[model samples]
Target: MKLLSRIDIRQLRILSSLLQERNLSRVADQLGVTQQAVSDQLKKLRETLDDRLFIRTSNGVIPTPYAESLQPKVEHILAALEDLLTPQTFDPRTVTRTLTLCSTDLEQIVILPKLLKILRREAPGVRLAVKKLELDQLSTSLLTGEVDLVISNPDFAPPSYPSLSLYPEHYACVASKANKTVRKQMTVEQIAQIPQVVVSPSRGDFSGAANSWFEQQGHPRNVVLSVPTFSAAKACIAESDICGFIPARLLPDARLRVIELDADVPGFEVIAVWHNRSSQDPLHQWLREQLLAVATTP
Candidate 1:
């Protein structure tokens, strides 16, 4: 008989749970089993693997080197099996799972509160974890199960992943409510003369879509500050003589006033991107629907 054949997949699941929960009793509670049952599974797993998988500690348990090495593989296996066994019909009110998403702080500020409010009322059992979206790493993160959805500009999404347009990212100029240089409306030339606080997603470059549009129109902005997020750029504009072009949704700030610019800066499409594997998944599809519903609201 093969040594591996002696172990059931359930035993590996216990080890995986142990890696997360650490305490045998906690793992039992999570799995809806008893501590003695978890110990039996661990004993079987240790016998099959020929190693002590966990060592008792004052807190609970610590994984041995061998068990640590098995952790990722075990997790991947369990996730795959769960997906395979997942029901076609999903009940958000009853399902308990965390949906991981990738987004920027600005998007989180604009979108998460509304979405979370809806979830809190409708799907209390579900949880969300939003991570920062790194453009170059998005494709790999989606394919490798690091993030389930990415809310980003369409241009930044990987072509391999399927996407749905969430909204048009429009920008308008903002300045301190007390700034004397800005008025109800500014001409293209007047707008160009003011020092601009440019939002560069990467935080170092003072260039962005507005800058590109300005150059295309034969007038480049006099950039005096570079910021990483719309919130920061708005704060910079509100506290200084600098003006910033921010998303239209980020308007109505108490300390900042929006200035109507004569120059037209083009807007880009914001999209919700997902891996091919999740395109047909009911849970994922439901999540995308909720995002679309929230994103399109006035």
Candidate 2:
């Protein structure tokens, strides 16, 4: 307790800002402190913590493993302190805040367009930044305030975080309009024989959600090509004889024909995930509400 008391809250804020800003000059500018003064504070923090919190890098500074591990706890501590000191109110219309979100390309394509339209009207001053979703690091990122929200499959979300079902994910097979193998209706045998363009989001991985479903149903897929994103899969189907599986939420391109399969394709829920700490935050809650509204509409 005595050692902790020696630490200044202002220094803690500086450390937190460093994680976001990465560069000393930027942090100093944001905090209205000299670069040398920020360096001095970092020096004091390093001595107090007995760890080199950040190491100088070509781009800026990178947090040490110890510093990286401490980020979520520090963010929680600072947020709790701020909540205690300030009135709990967020005026979306006038507040200028940047919200960072992580999501797959599919969700970004399906969700962001409508959400951005609503935000333009409802929260004109708010800004949004979207980062590609890194599933393994999402939980820690959310807890540390590195990302404000995550839109992804429920299975990918950490169990510790609170999640709300955004929509039920449905998939359909797509093929070029010129492909003769695909018709109005397809049976298991016919679908199995046709070459498939499987979307393996990780790129190198050979299997995906649709592949797993095919396995469970005792059907074999001839995966002619493996791609990383829905757009790529659709493009492959549009140009080639091979068919691709795509989430139903994505509108069908006029060039590609949607193939109706008789066999069942397993569906999972797309979820909006966030750390429990932000569950009651006005901005967070409002964002979730808007996402739910967009997801449920049509």
Candidate 3:
């Protein structure tokens, strides 16, 4: 407890500078502190955090995974400290900036309508840009402010980023109503026999989100098709004997019918994840509130 208390604001500033500058001497020079002073602080940070945090490279120093994770959080802490002196104020109607969101089609179909209504009625000048969800680019895009919020299931957010649960969602085993072979319910063994279609937008891989759960039940998923979008998967599944697990909210389609599983698939929470730098910013604050209102309302 005492060791952690030694991590004062100056050490945090040094940590941030070192993460960006990636050079001990350069960080020291930038912060107007001695190289030894920086090293002493780094040593303290390592002990307090219990992570090496950085390693010496030929060029200078590169942050370890633990250190990389801390970068955004440290910046947020610094930002919050800085915000204490500079007051922020804004009006929703007067705002004229576009907020970019990284999300999947599921969110676009389910959440965006309500959110757009609120935006149009309240913050008319605020434009919204939603890009396709790319999980690999999530950390970098958010850190650089290329994306404001990532609306997806909980698994996609980086460990350090802040997130709010927009809504709860569960999957439904769906197939074409035309699939006569399957019925209203199927056991794990029965469902495993059928070839399934999956949605993998960013990659051309056979891997799926629920494959492991199926495998745990002693039936490795036999994925016969992988499509880029839910609509594509739906079209394919609706026509063929193949099936998929899709969100329940997108159902009741004339072409599709639900296939109940005895052992239900676990649900996921759709969250709006954002970098912490926007924590105190009024635009993000107001926008998150509006999103929460729309998502949580019955």
Residues 1-298 of candidate 3: C-alpha lDDT, one tens digit per residue: 8765778999999998888889999998999989999999899889888999999999989999999998778877788887786456678988889999988888888789999998899899999999998888998888867899998777777878898888888888888898888999889888888899888767757887889889899998789999867888888998899988898888878899888888979888999998878887788999999889988886
- Pick out the ten consecutive residues of candidate 1 with the lowest summed lDDT: 200-209
Which ranges in model 2 have alpha carbons more than 4 Å from their true place? 19-26, 51-65, 140-144, 202-204
Candidate 1 at residue 69, lDDT? 85
Q: Rate the local accuracy (lDDT) of all candidates.
A: 0.83, 0.84, 0.87
Among all windows of ten consecutive residues in candidate 2, which has the lowest summed lDDT?
A: 199-208
Q: Which ranges of candidate 1 are over 4 A from the true structure?
A: 1-84
TM-score of each: 0.71, 0.86, 0.73
- Lowest summed lDDT across 10 adjacent residues in model 3 is found at 81-90
Note the residue pairs that clash in candidate 1.
none
Clashing pairs in 2: none
Tens digit per residue, CA lDDT, model 1, 1-298: 6986887777877887898779999999988999999999898888888999899999999999988888667766666777788887878788677989888776798889989998898789889998876877888788656799999887678987799988888887888999997898988778888999876665367777677788877778899888777888887888889887888787778998888877676888888998767776677888889889998998
Over 69-95, each residue of candidate 2 has an lDDT whose tens digit, in order, gives 887778888887876775566777976
lDDT over C-alpha atoms for residue 22 of model 1: 90
Candidate with the larger TM-score of 1 and 2: 2
lDDT of 1: 0.83
